[model samples]
Each structure stands twice: as structure tokens, then as C-alpha cells.
Target: MRSVWPLVLPVCSALLSANLSAQPTETTPATSAPEMPTEAMNSCLQASIPSAAATMTVAELRQGCQLLYEQQLQSAGESELQEQQVSSEDSTGDKGERLLKRRMTLEALNRANRFMLTPHKINYFFPASYTRTPNESPYRDNDNESLSDLSKAEADFQLSIKILLREDIFGDNGHLYLGYTNHSLWQLYSDADSAPFRETNHQPELILSFTNDWEFLGFRNVLNDVILNHQSNGQGGLLSRSWNRVMLNSVFERGNFAFALNPWYRLPESAQEYPGDPDGDDNPDITDYMGKFEFNAAYQRKDDIYSVMLRNALDGDNRGALELGWSFPISSNLRGQLKYFKGYGHSLIDYNVDLEVFALGIVFTDLF
Candidate 1:
């Protein structure tokens, strides 16, 4: 599956779009509008106008025609709304159709290779990330006496992206995708230590995506994803941390709010005969802290977004994590992020250690 079209798809997402309201005009009154193209008018224009050596841009031409259409509609004292606008909600309160269709269009573009790569997760960097608990036992276990001091403050960032492998690979349902995500922690403030990267986790996944419309108690199920996932820290011996899992991701959306539930099962590996054994399970008790499932919710209020994540180990130890985040628009193309985390599994190297973290940064891509 990884070799299929350079490997693309990864997981789940459903996009949101706002309704358009007409701007106040000098002569005409308007209420609301949706982006719609006039097929007949476009066909007529193409037949009449000279195609070769075109001087006018498509936007200019479209704007002129749209103005004419609006004037005609206003003359009849009626408002025209698009019948196919995904933003339109039903009176029964069964929403998510809008978001569902929008996602379908995005996936269609991916299949067409027009937008092959898409954001799989929130991409952000915090140069001044502070963690109250820094795991130093690994360094101590390494016996590298020269590196004893581990800073509590560091820089952290994550990059996650996916590409479409094939749309309708199952003839109608499954859309295959390959995704890669990278997480890294850097000791940028430790200038005395030359600012080396402390740990980096690499994840590459295969996803089978399906569009769904199931609803229960006013909530709409918009997406379902079956994923094969592998993550590793690219280390050896006692420092090695790696695991593989089969995961299920189900996403739901209602109005400007979205939610996701992800559960995974770890694949078992052989136990080690002794410490630092080469061919044995690394971090065999990782699940005891990282948990078996995660839940995420995001709510968008105009240009600002608020999100929260929760996880529980579902065992006697009852270990897990909680992360809260806020993203506000800084400019037309920029957004600022503030995040707080209290829990375990901030990084693979510190899976067993609990920490409280606060970070402020800028976001390149965000959760929708």
C-alpha cells in the first residue's frame, strides 16, 4: 500500500465554511449569497466570445455576469440562494451535510492531484515551551556523565501532512491515503549545550477513509478512518521507543463544532531476555501511560478556534493526558496559538513521566 502512488492518505478531517452575506450597496439590497456558477451563461459566453488571445481574466468576467444576475433577481423582489450550498442546514437540525460535501470536494481535488498534499494535524512551533517534568533517567541510564543537566525549557514543533493514494479504491467507499507526521523537541535555550535536538518521533501511516452520514441524538457522523500506524524515535537499546497499531478514527461535526474519537490496539512484540536487548519490545509498558483511546473536540467562533483533547489509560494506573489549545487569527494568513498540557506521553522518551506544559506559538495549519 505504501508504494501506491507514492503513498498518501492518513486519517480524518471534515472542513467548515462560513455563509456569505451581501455587502451593503449603493443602489441594490441583498441578504445572503452562496458561490454558484451559471452553467448556461458560461456556455453562451464561451460560444460567443473569442477564446484565443483573451485579455480579460476569468474573475472579472464572472463578476460582471454575477452583478447582472443579482440586478435581475433584485428587480423581481426575491433573493436567490444556491440549492447546492453545503452551508445550508436542514430544519430538522440534521447538520453535517454541508461539512460532509465540502470534504468530498477536497478529497475529489486530492484524487485529481490538484491538491495532493493536505494538513493532517495542527502544525505549530513553540520556541519557549516549558515542561515542569523533564525525564533525565534515560540520559543517566545511558551512562553519559557529561550530559546530566536536562533543561525544563525547550522548543517543540510538529509537522503532519498527507497525500491521496487513490479515491474509491474499494470501487465506491474506501479512499486510500498515506500520511507522515514528525514531532521534535529542541534545546534551543540551552545555548551552553549547543542546542541539540533531544528527541524526535517519526510516524508514517496508511489510512482507509470512508464518508458516512449516520446520525444519533442530533449529532452527525461525517467521517470514519481505519488506519495502520507505526511510530518510532529512531534510537537503539534502552533509548529505543517504537510501536505499531491498528487504529479507528471517527469524526463528527455539528455546526461550527467538531469532534473525533480515536481508539488503537498495539501490536505485541517479543519480550526482552535482558535490559538493552537488541531484538525485543521497546517500552513494553508504553500503553500503561499513553492510553488506548483519545478524544478531541474543536469549536470555532468566527476566526478563533478552541480545542481540547482527553485520554485515559483505562487500567489500574489510570494514566493519561489532557491538552487544551486556542488559536486566534493574527492576520489574513497568520494565526497565533496558546496551548497547555498536563499529562504523560508528551514525548516518547518521557512516556512514563507526567508533566505540565505551557506553550505560546504561531500556527501554520490548524484543526478544523
Candidate 2:
């Protein structure tokens, strides 16, 4: 790592030299606010080291400081900032006004009522794909029509979005969020059919989160979220698939790593009335594949971030899913993401179907 001491010493010496040889300014009225450091260098120094000029006069900055004073002030400011892991407050305007403005700005930025989590940012269009369409469809059995009669094309696309409903309704620590995610397998290359959505799944969930910062078990406690989730394909009859669940999630962090554990209980559904019924609780054995709990772990390595998700039934029958993801910087506010999935529960329709999928897309936010 480059040492700032070399660069800082010379610069500080020059500034001290200049300050010791500068002239004083005329005194102003007692009620008038003093002029602040406004030059690029002065502003930067003040921002990085607020105490460096806490009691310095304009004349001192311009012509009165010696090497010893500058060194002491710089060391003190740097030590405090490093210990707190926070930047020094900006020094501008009158003391009271500046402090008030800073407080207001910080509150606005962190208000719990305001939108905290991002809603819809990850959406991508792909020109190639593969998939096994559902053998039975609700629309076909109910209406005596083929809902997915078309053949799978060589190219397809998918779209999804999420929304935040409420944040910190009770206080600064509690949050309520509503999210929706949709996935579609489109036959984009089928000119004869005009690109119909071969398979579409809709997922909506309501989640309540409570956050606290502390250290436990060598890890930092991040947040806890309780979720009521519903997922289904907007289909009916033999092809219908849907489920509801109540889940508990806990998140933790340690240095460059973030980890989460999610456990859920499936809400019971009314059974179909008759033996031939095709509707109620479509996939009763879904838990056999989807599992009751999942774990997510993410780590940052330099500019790239990697994440892994794992789920297991924990019963004698071995079944679950595993997903691996990597995200790298693509721009200032955007990141390119690549994901690979193996096993079941990739989607509601594929809850019981073993499948493998690889996806490349852009993510607007980092898990960090």
C-alpha cells in the first residue's frame, strides 16, 4: 500500500511555510461568521481531518501555522476518523447552521419511512434458451384447449421485478416490504406464433424485517426478517401450481462475508374434494424437493463478489437445490452477474423437476 506520510509531509510543510509568511486579514464584527476554508486543497484537508482546523483562523491557514501544529492536528484527526470508521463532518458555514444541515441531510438519507430497499432493477433479455414445457396445463384441461401446444424455440427471454411496500412502520428498526418476481419462457424466434410466453410464473411476497447491530458468535448480527410468501403460475386445471409459506430469515456479517439462514413452514391447503380433482394443493409433496430451510452466503474478493445458496430437505430422502452467483463491476452503479443453478425448486412450476440453468445478467445492487 502507498504511504500517505511521504505525500502528507511535503504538502503539510509547504502549507505551513506559506501560512507562516502570509499577512493577516482585517477583523470582522463579532456577530459575523468567519470565512471557512474553501479552496480545493483546504476543503479536502478539512473534510479528511476536521480537527486540523477546528480553531485555526483564516490567517493561520494562509500564513501562521508551524510544522509542529500541522502535524499534531493531522495526526489527531486521522486517528479519530480511523477509530470511528466514519468521515469527519464537513466544516462549512456557521457552526450551528452547518451542524443542523448535516443532521437533516443524514436523517433524510436514512429515514425508515423512505424507500430503503431497491424495487425493480434486474431485468434482462436473452436470445437463446432451452426448457421442458409442462406436460399438463390448467387452461387446456378446463377449456379443452392447448395452452402450450407450440414447440420450444432455440431462443427465449425472461423478465422480473420487485417492489418495496413499507419501511420502519413501527420505528427505525422495523420494515415491511412487498416484492413481486416474474419469470417467463418466451418463444421469441417463433415467427408463426408471434413470440408467445411459453411458461410464466408469478411470485409475490410480504416481508417484515427488524434490524439491529451487534456482535455474536464471532459474527455481526445484521437483521431478521419474517416473510409470508405466495407463488404460482397463472394457470388452472391440471397445470395449476401454487403454495404459501411463513418463513423466518436471519442475516449476519463478518468482515467481507455476509450470511443468511432461512427456515419456512408451508401453510396447509384444503385438499381436493374428489379423487380426480386437479386443483387444491397441486403439489402436496413439494417440500420433499423444495426443503424447509435454506442458507445463503456471500463474500467479496477485491472488485468481484460471489454468493452461494443451498437448501436441503434434512429428511432421510436427499433432495434440494444449489445456486452459485458471481457479480463484477460493469459500471459505477451497475454490476454484471452470472449465476448457475443445479437441483430442484428453481421455480414453482419446476418445484419437483430436477433442472440445471445458467444465467448471465446485470444486477443494480450488491448484497453488501
Candidate 3:
């Protein structure tokens, strides 16, 4: 593959250079010539023809080009006629009408020029945010004074291959997303103070969606969604794991109100060996089952998006939890979110062990 890239690079570069070189010729027909049809152009356009007998006759080719050129001229004449009519209608109007007519003419010229010259565009955004926690939870029991002291900041970076696939194949609404995230605490605590806690996580998921605009069963926007996720914990084996999930979600929207319910299941790696115990004798291998339901509503249109969620599990025992969050878009490409979670669950832990946790964190997202 390494050797192939070097060979492939020049071929692609040459192709692009040829395409760029042809743009001027396509846009500007030589004034010195009579614009007569040529056999070379015909051959280039009809290279798929197996033989000269199958190619367009000289007379036919000439007639085709003449027809096309005449059609373009006729279209230009029609546009000029339309403009004249508009100017005549505005002649008896006020200054605003004259300005509007001038603007319309300029817009028409710009549109024509754009059709002749293809252009490319690029956009970029950056994200940064801070969070502060007021209470200590089981998941964040360190001596950190504020939430910012425990999980000081969050950052996200994302890039998307726009419209990588058409909407029809998967449905009318689908997105291809690629992203990376980083989270960390303030540099004041020792290793023991943050021991066994995850400092950073990396996630990337692809989503396919289908939706109906109208609400059914009192639901506003109804959507069917499927997601595949891969995640990694920056910690050691105890925290490092990856899983894949499939989900179906429905959303309802009416006026400024909206809500959603998401049901999902995850398949995790084989738990043949428990983390931190080489003997694998501490806990029995358990199958993991997961589900989630979420609701969201808009408010203030800025810095005040609120949402609530319920998550459940039955891997070894029954466990259920609830979460609430607020999120706001900081920029067209970035958003900041703060969320709080509380869980009552013996299922997430070993059957012999009981655990409870309350956690709060902030998330920053870069969307494309």
C-alpha cells in the first residue's frame, strides 16, 4: 500500500491538472475561429464508439452544435426581454423599485458567471468550555473543590465527509460522522486521588436515520435511528473497553415543544477475564444488556436547551438510572452541554456488590 500511494499520487494529480486546464477552453470559445464543429471534439466526446461508422456524421455533428448554440442565444434573449419588462414596470415606481431592479440584474449576471466558473468552499470551527461541580458523588469523590477541579475542561474535534452517501439508500435522513474527544481534571490532585477514574474517552459513531415530519401518537417528529459506536478509555484494561449498539428512536415535536424516546441494545466484548484480577476468580462472567430513553425541549433559543434521560441495565441484575442536562450551541459548529446523572443499580456491579453513583460532567461537540 505504501508503494502504491506514491504511484497513485502522480496519476491523480495529473488528472486534476488536466481538468483545471480545460476550464478556460470550455468557458471561452476562441474568437478567431468561426466556432465550427471539429472531428477531434466529436471523437473525444464519443470515444465509446467502436468505429468511425458508429460515430456521428460531420453534418449531424455540425447541426447538433448549431442547435445548442442557438438555444443558448435564445435563452439569453428571453432573459434580456424579461429584464426589460421588469425595468418598464418599475419605471413608474419609487427609488426603492429602481434599487431592487438593479440588484436583480446584478444577481442574474452573478448567477451566470457562477455557472461558468465552478468554485469550492471550506468552513472551520473551534470549541472550548469549562464545568464546575458543586457536590461530590460516588463517581467523583476526590477532594477536588469544584467540578472544574475534578473534571476541569472538555474539548471535541470533528470532521465529516459531507453527503458521503445519498439519503435514499439508507433513508431520507442519514449522516456520516467522525469525531474525537478529550477530558481532563485540573493539575492539582495526586495519582491516588484520581486512581481508577477515567480521565479521557474517545468515541466515534455512524448514524443512519429515517423520519416522518408529522407527529403520531402525540409524538412530534418520528424518527428511526441506527448507530454503531466504538469507545476507548484512556485508563488501563480495567477501564478500556469497546462495544457496538443498535438503536430505534422516536421524537415528537409540536410548536416549541419536543420529546424523544430511544431504545437500544449493546454487544460488548467477551468478559472471560475480569479487570485488575489476573486470577479471574473475583466475579463471574456476565452478559451485558442496556437500554435508554431520553426527552428534550427547547428554551430561550440560546444557552438553555434542557433534556432528561432514563437509562437501564439488566446484565446480571436490574438497574435503572436518570439524568438531566442542558446544552447550548456556542457556534455553528460547536456546542457545550452540562449533564447530571444519578443511578440506583446493583446490576452494573457484581451480584455480591452494591453500588450507587451520582455524576456530573460537561461535553463539547463539533458538528458537521
Candidate 4:
């Protein structure tokens, strides 16, 4: 029965082959017919697979109808990796730009601080003339002996340190100044035989000042200043003096000319002594209120270095003084100035100490 079954299977296979060969011998040409249009093909495929139809393009529908196939392929490939790399580089570049801007701002602030903290150098000259009678006598004697008739010259070289405090510490446009001065002078001349004859005068002074620019009467720019000064000499002939002064100054400007008026008052610290009798032995006390008014006119040039000041003082004795000064830079750290002053007064000439006096001096300054 097994042998018969095997022979039956072979006959069946032959029969099937014979039937297929006899049924379809029809021959078709290579260009049998034009292929269906892409839209028609896609419509036919979409009808067969309705879910794919909604998203299908004609070419993709004809080729393959798979969900997320292209997207998955792209994600696994270099295109997606390249996009991510580019996004990362852009983020890093943005961060770098922010950091660069921050660094530049810091650098600019540091440079400005360097300029603001820089130090300054200053120099100044202080020359004062004092005249008093040789004796307590108010009138000139027949002997023609008076300390006021005697001429003396004293000058000081001062180096100042300037610092900017609050502009509003005292008031708007106000400034504070602190200064120390070392001074030495030659007595020039003294009459030991005469009463109250002076040997020499020398001393040091410490000064503090506050100054302001204020408007007066709504039209005038007035300079209001206050000064506290302390002067001392170890010598017994002259006593220590401490006083404060308040001054009001006004300036008028016209073309290249400037005029200034200053009125000031000095408060006494203590009683001051003067020479009384001959042999330089007797001394008398002189204490009183002192006030002074000064008028000045100046011609200024563009250089601001060369100018002449015609100054007159109105006090107990009317006096006129002329001052000529010149300023120039000597070096980066040093500066120089030359000044001259001449004055005459009845009190200064007849009753007081000095008559006609001249002074010459130079100064050097440095900044750090």
C-alpha cells in the first residue's frame, strides 16, 4: 500500500504541471501597456489599506506603507546626529558670548577705577608782611624810631595734599582742605639798642579750610570761605596765636579781565604783645578786632600761567599792593612759580614795622 501511495503522489504532481502548462501559453509584448498612473495606483492601494490612505503619498504608497519607518531610519542615521551636534554647538557659542561680554565689562570698570584712584601733587606760596611800632607809642617820636619803618621780608614754601571728600559734606560746591607748612625766615634787621627791637621771626603753621561757591542776590556768584589756622613759636618774644577767618569774595569777568572783591574778618585767639621801650626789654599787650577788605584786578591769557594782580587792602590803614606771578611745569612730578609783591601804607611805613619790602622765592612739587 505504501509503494502505491508513492507512485500516486508523483502522478498527481505531473498532472498539476501539465494542467498549468496547457492553460496559460499566452505571450505578452514587452511594451504591453503603459503602467497605471501613480495617483490611480495609490488610490487602488489606499482602498485596499484604508488606514494607510489618510497619510499616504503616491510614491510611498506604491513603495511601502509603514508607520514611522522613515522617521525611525532618519533617527538612527547621520542626519539626526548632525542636527543635534549643530544645536549643541550653537548653545555653547551663546554661552561663550555672554561670558565674553561679562569679562569686557569688568575690564572697563577696572580701568576707570585706576584713573579715579590716582594721586595728585600740589605746591603753594604764602607771604605775609607785618608792621608794628617799635614802642607802644601810637605816634612817631622825634627820634624817628619805629618798627613799622623797618623793612622785613618773610616767605613760606608749602606743600599741600589734596583729597576729594563728599561734595556735599559742607554744602554743594564745597571742598575741604588740610595743609601743613614748614617755614623759616631771616630777621633781616633788628635794632637791639632800640626799644622792642626784634631779633628774628620764625614759625610753622597748620591750616584747615572749607570753601563754597554760592549765589548772592540771585545774580552774583560769591565765594564763601572759612579758614582755621594755628601758629606757634617756641621763642618767648612772640606768643602762640590761633584764629579763624570768614571771607566773602565776588568775581566779575569781562573779556580777558577779572576783578575780585574780598571782605574778611579775623577773630582773635589771645592777646598779642608788642615792643614797649628801648633796650628791647619792655613789652605791651595789644588786642583788638581786625578786619580787611581787598580789591583785585587781573589780566589773564589763554595759557593761564602769566597774570598780573593789582591788589589793594582797606583796613585800619589804606594800602595798595601789586603782585606779579608766573607758573610753569618743570617736569612730570615737579612744578615752579615766581611771584613779586610791593606795598606802602602809613601804618606800615610810619607807625608799624615794615615800610618797603621785596621778596623772591621758588617752589618744587611732586605727585604720587
Per-residue lDDT of candidate 2, residues 43-109 (tens digit)? 4344333322233344433322222233334344431110011122311112222222222222222
Order candidates by lDDT, high to low.
1, 2, 3, 4
The candidate scoring highest on lDDT is 1
Ten consecutive residues with minimal summed lDDT in candidate 1? Answer: 1-10
- lDDT string, candidate 4, 62-137, tens digits: 4332212222333344221111112333322222222222222222222222233211122444344333322223
Give candidate 3 misplaced runs (Cα > 4 Å): 1-166, 170-198, 273-303, 314-318, 326-339, 344-368
lDDT comparing candidate 2 with the true structure: 0.51
lDDT of all predictions: 0.67, 0.51, 0.32, 0.31
Name the top TM-score candidate. 1
- Which residue pairs does candidate 3 place in steric collision? 133-147, 219-252, 220-252, 220-253, 221-251, 221-252, 221-253
Pairwise TM-score winner, candidates 1 and 4: 1
Cα-based TM-score, every candidate: 0.76, 0.61, 0.41, 0.38
Select the stronger candidate by TM-score from 1 and 3.
1
Candidates 1 and 2 compared by TM-score, better number: 1
The TM-score that candidate 4 achieves is 0.38
Residues 113-186, candidate 3, lDDT per residue (tens digit)?
21222110011122332334212242333333333233333332222221122233444234322222222322
Instruction: Please say which candidate is ahead in TM-score: 3 or 4.
Output: 3
Among residues 3 or more apart in sequence or in different chains, the pairs in candidate 4 whose N, CA or C atoms overlap within 3 Å are: 131-353, 132-352, 132-353, 134-147, 147-353, 148-352, 148-353, 195-277, 195-278
Q: Give the poorly placed runs of model 1, Cα more than 4 Å off.
A: 1-104, 145-147
Candidate 1, residues 11-70, lDDT tens digits: the string is: 234442221112222233323554335695586346424421133346544543444444
Clashes of 2: 4
Q: Give the TM-score of candidate 1.
A: 0.76
